[model samples]
Target: MTERIYTAGLVVIGDEILSGRTHDKNIAQVASWLQVQGIRLSEVRVVPDVIERIVEAVNALREGYDYLFTTGGIGPTHDDITVDAVAEALGVPVVVHPQARAILEKYYADKPGGLTEARLRMARVPEGAELIPNRMSGAPGIKLGNIHLMAGVPHITAGMLDALTGTLEGGAPLLSETVGCWTPESEVADILRQVEQAHAKCQIGSYPFFREGRVGANFVVRSTDEGDLKSCVDSLCDGLATAGFDFTPGGI
Candidate 1:
């Protein structure tokens, strides 16, 4: 039987992200982290900070994938609405988690704010959600069902991801090898299809680029099994060479 590969979806929530005021970086990092956990980042949607929009995105992604992650709109500011929206999506009332409040109280005891109302907002979560530790900031990430609510800040998100490492159940990590060629993709299209079709467990992706006034392409071969991955790469390289093209081991 084929192994079950876990998949995740991401909903990036913030008006700032949609407005391009803040360049979103959470997607790439989250994707990399999930990959380490053997889960594929299958889908991603960027939505404004509006509660209805957040609810829509959250419900859609969570229902389709094994896991769903949201970044942004979880801050202390007025526009912060991820928690509320997620609670709505789950059809649960928002409540201030006792442990979360206590954590915030302890975290802010010596800080200048001293766990003010604004800071306490971070302690609120969906009725049954749990906390995902945030070492960088006192405001912890929230976990409800398969949905994870994280920080918009890349560094903070990294910290949360570190805390979550090795906790999720997953299958094997995906592996890939890239072969770069100083030739057009069209020239090797048939070779790529032929090689990929011969390998049931492998996939090849073609990325074309123009540089130094020359057309070139990179073929990335991927598989969950290392041996199959290498075999596919070697076969692709052989095919390219037989077609009279000099290919680079790694993409340029």
Candidate 2:
């Protein structure tokens, strides 16, 4: 039987990201997590804190992928309108989740300001949503159907991802092998293309880098099947050897 392929989309919602005030790290982190979950992050959209833009991105991505994850605009601040926008996109009402409220109440009980309205905003979600616990902070992540709402903070998002590790159903995890060479990528461009074409199931990505006044590249071979990945890597290595290029197994 042919193996299933699971895909996901990400919507990065924040004005800070677009303004270059806060560098977006969630994309790389989420993509890596999805890879371990056997889901490919097929698409990504970065939008500002505008509700209409968020709603448009949410609606578009949710319908196109098996899973959709949004990071940012879910905090207590006024700009944190991810939940409201997502609810609008899904045609649902935003409601305060009692369990989330209870969590916040308890978390802030010992603090100076106890469960103020601002903090209470974190408890709100789409009418039919579940909570993804955030061990790092009081605010919990939101989950509605295939849409996962997470924090923009890298550490908080990491905690949310940890909570969601085994809950998602995915296909075979993608496996990768890297080969590095101290030669310009253009020198072996044809070889890379030919090797990838011969292995229909494998993909070859060449990432070139300049370091210490020299040019080098790392060729990453990826496939869901271990055999296909290994075969592709071996073929590329053999081709590099025949071409009289010294290569490194891991990366340059």
Candidate 3:
């Protein structure tokens, strides 16, 4: 039997996001990254900055999934309660991690001035948590058990996620193949359905892309098993050929 690899879900916590003040970009990036590692995103929730709400989401997702990632609400502002709630959810106390503090001090201490208490807030981590290095800024994120706490800012969040993924143990990586057909989906819907049913283990998705006043569709087949993916693609191409639809085996 193939080993059961770990999977992760995301929790984006912030009043700004819930209020529509800021659009979230973390979920999509994180999803794509995890997909490359053969880890599926089972679920995602966007919650406000309320401590109870954050704690509840963290606890639920952490228990159900192999990993839980929370983005936003780790800033210095008063509304940044992600660290505190994560600690609460895990029954741990929040404390300034020495390594995280040192990272912060290195950057801020040399600036014409010195690090302040407000800036130091970024170094807080749940007890027994390991620090996830921030690739951009020195202020590291925190990882407590299976929960990864990251910054809300897109660049910083992306950096933290990169750092976390770099250190994680991964299973087989996902592979993808795309075939484009000029024919309308309605004309080829039946063939697509048959191919999908036959390749149940692979994700078969149809996306429409318009170019040069012509509408075309792309059928993507993705799977963690490379051999299975190629086999499914070959079968899909054969099915398309039998349907009399002109198709290309590769995508743009």
- Give the top-scoring candidate (lDDT): 2
Task: State each model's CA lDDT, in order.
Answer: 0.92, 0.96, 0.84
TM-score rank, highest first? Answer: 2, 1, 3
Residues 1-252, candidate 1, lDDT per residue (tens digit)?
888999999999888888888898999999999988999999999998789988998999999999999998888889898999999989999999999999999999999969999988999999999999999978999998898999999999999999999988878999888999989999999999999999999999999999999999999998999999999998998998888999999887
**How much lDDT does candidate 3 score?**
0.84
Top TM-score: which candidate number? 2
Better of 1 and 2 by TM-score: 2
Candidate no. 1 TM-score? 0.96
> Judged by TM-score relative to the true structure, which candidate is superior, 2 or 3?
2
lDDT of 3 by residue, 1-252 (tens): 875776888999988887887888998998988886667788999999899999888888999998888888888779888989988888889899888888888888778657788788988888998888888976778887778888888999888877766566667767789998886667777887888788877888898877878878999998877888998999989998987878988963
Q: How close is candidate 2 to the true structure, as a TM-score?
A: 0.99
For every model shown, what is its TM-score relative to the native structure? 0.96, 0.99, 0.91
Per-residue alpha-carbon lDDT of candidate 2 for residues 196-229, written as tens digits (9 for 90 to 100): 9999999999999999999999999999999989
Task: Name the better of 1 and 2 by lDDT.
Answer: 2
Q: How accurate locally is residue 176 in candidate 2, as Cα lDDT from 0 to 100?
A: 94
lDDT of 1 at 131: 96
